[model samples]
Target: MASQDVVYTSTENHAGFKIDVVQYQPTKRPIEDRFSVSTKSSNRLLLGVYDGHGGSHTAEHISNILPTALLSHPPEKHAQIFRETDHTMIRAFTRDHSLLRPKSKSSDWVHHAQVVRAGCTALILDIDVNTLIASYANAGDCRAVFYPPVDAEGHLRQTEDLNAKTPSEQQRLAQEHPGEDLVVVSGRLFGRLMSTRGFGDACYKLPHGTIGNWQHRRYIDALSAVKESGKIPMNSQYHAMFHTYRTPPYLTAAPEIGTMQLQKDSFVIMATDGLWDCVSSNDAVQIVRGGLEQEVDNLAEHLLHSVRATRAPGDDVTILLLHIIHT
Candidate 1:
């Protein structure tokens, strides 16, 4: 459940910039209208993919809140703002819930808590100076992708020195690490009924210790009770979101932040459940690099178009694109 922080090394020269933002929310049935935008700025650009859960309010809140945070803060505090946005959104959801729910004596706003509990997965990719920073804050299982310098042939390829798990790679994730089980375990071991980490769903997770710890502690002996105790039991039902919760927390906001530089050709993408449900990072990268030459701006928009055109429309598809300009 370690979630936050970033710093990137600058390349020798900086040159290109492109940003793409898109979202798909199934308001009705036949058509899925998601939010999307493409922008080309003088030097800096912001591309974000916020895949929201529970309600349109939460999805929409990310659309509203992220811009405000970016607009309000200077470059230095952007990471801090990302962390703060979770609390801010939860508060906003709580407030908005009041509008939908009329106060009742017995109701006590308990039923309406789900609205506040609704959390969004946020992936913010920022290109500032010569550095590229990737920040991922998720309540559930939204994903982000970093495509390193492509080959001379201009394919969206990467030699993974260090990067976040690709969508396909993450599918293979067997289990959580010790101390990282905040979101995996549900209900009381002895009376602790809740998740260990996350944002929004405050009803289950705590300001701290919501995700269960999964890291392997140094076991004292071959058959020590304490070390064996830390292992999550197989066949033991647990809540990932409130989807598995007994009473259900239904909210979360645990963020994992990572960074790299434009030493080579680099493109970073952030997306919500819409694309992640089907598309893999490598799959998306091929589309991004193949859509258009990296030399031009608007790669982000092109990427959105590519994903939208190809992906099966079972859910909303949201994507944000940031292309490194190596001058």
Candidate 2:
């Protein structure tokens, strides 16, 4: 068994505001989750959490590039940025057909396939420090919750979860596919992926022969190599999914964006599903609230410890906490 690894970081105190981040990796496999924090200037701060499935490649790539991409574009263009980034990833994979040549090793093909088959959920928060306004964009199940509850005109602000299990998401898939009965089964997209929106996972996003004929053929060949190598089970449901893949772009990376004004002592927690799987939203808020009341040194780390006490995490857990305070 591999030992658990934890990463913790805290930013310098700025006008009594601070951010804390922590990640716990317990699995033997390389952690597929990635996160980033960019204090671009005194007035701007960017934070993101990416949860990758199938492999870590997509998450790592997004973590490295998304912060910069978001910073380059205006806040209104963030959704377009997410979609363009997904397209860029697919284009990069299609341009490298040499990896699919017969002479290439199966392992080589598998590595290249990661660029297309792996996908990641992204949740980004762009903050205007001086104004204490935060704009959030979410693409998957990763969640951002505000302590003391960010209420708008007497109602709590809510963000929908973009996954097959969500009723509206299921309805959207059915409506998009029309008569496709298997668009969702057992609360999964084609009974394979839980996320209905994210970056990468080109195999799910690209339609048959959408890429040039030659490139699509090479893509199929690479997938066959990956299967033959037994990296994935031969009888996996994905086999059926590929054969039945009719409508292209069964998933999307377009983020749902919203903004809120911050208040002193208000806390925002952004985390991957790994933490949410074991911790309830209300419980998480209480934990953070308690930490703040007690003036803990690192609230993110404290919340992580609280989660581990109940049960060992089955996946990589990441937590980012932003605390607003007065000097």
Measured by TM-score, the strongest candidate is 2
Q: Can you give the lDDT of residue 104 in candidate 2?
A: 38
lDDT minimum window of 10 residues, candidate 2: 228-237
Q: Over 4 Å off in model 1, which ranges? A: 1-16, 25-44, 70-80, 88-117, 130-140, 149-199, 202-252, 263-265, 293-311
Task: Give a tens-digit lDDT track for model 2, residues 49-148.
Answer: 9999877878988999899999987678899999998887776555555545343365544555675667899999898887878899999999998766
- Per-residue lDDT for 213 in model 1? 26
Runs in model 2 deviating more than 4 A are: 1-15, 98-113, 150-158, 210-217, 223-230, 233-238
lDDT for 190 in candidate 2 is 79
Q: Per-residue CA lDDT of candidate 1, range 1-327, in tens?
A: 001100111112224654555444444432211232322344445455555443444455565556556645544565567567666644443443343554444343433343344434555544454444432333334555667643686454322211122332222221332233333333321124222223343434322124432111110110121112344432242233223333232233444454545544566666555566666777777878786565434554455555656654467665556555454
| Overall lDDT per candidate, in order of appearance | 0.43, 0.78
The RMSD (Cα, Å) of candidate 1 is 13.5
